[model samples]
Target: MAARFRMKRKGVGEMLRMPGMEAEMLRRAEVIKGVAIGLSPVDENGPHPGHYKASWETSSTRRGGRKRDRAVGYVRNTAYYARWVEYGTEKVHAHHVLLRAAQIGGRNQ
Candidate 1:
């Protein structure tokens, strides 16, 4: 007597499109955005005040079809000085807020 077995693959495209996938990705992105905003520096007395913190935004996207199916999350600060605040300038030290937030947020998922 012999046993026969076969493995069937349903593919990942369908799974990528599954009910909560997009929402979950968006949620994670939001988490990252929140963390980034919290870690961002606030110039209380500066001309922009809370502009940097207020610029934090979140976005999510699904792409690459079945073979490379994946969800991407983005947390961005639209402030003109975002780079200066993050990477710092001549007299400032890099804050690395987004980097820290992404590390923390990625661990959350």
Candidate 2:
């Protein structure tokens, strides 16, 4: 008697659209969002103290045809000054809050 082996060919695109994949992406996005909020600088002396931190949010999307072939997670700050805080101007130092959060979240996952 000989042992038999079989493999199903689903491909990467189909694998991404799986229900579990979207769930995982959303979970990771939440993690990343939390980390970003923690890392965000709080300007207590400024008028809008903690505004940047409070702006942290997470969203997930599927991209492709009608079936939607890709799952993507996003962590973003809605504050108008978000870019300035993350990248910084000549007068201010770059915090790289979101960048650090993503790095931390990726390693955690």
Best by lDDT: 2
lDDT digits (tens) for residues 18-79 of candidate 1: 54776787898899888898888887889989999999988776663345566656678899
Report the lDDT tens digits of candidate 2 across residue range 1-109.
9999665556777787777777889899999888888788898899999899999888777663456668877788999999999999999999999999999988988
Per-prediction count of colliding residue pairs? Answer: 0, 0
- At residue 63, candidate 1 shows an lDDT of 61
Off by over 4 Å in 2: 1-10, 64-68
Give Cα-based local distance difference scores for all models. 0.81, 0.86
Instruction: Note the residue pairs that clash in candidate 1.
Output: none
TM-score of each: 0.76, 0.84
For candidate 1, the per-residue lDDT at 90 reads 93
Give candidate 1 regions above 4 Å deviation: 1-10, 17-19, 64-68
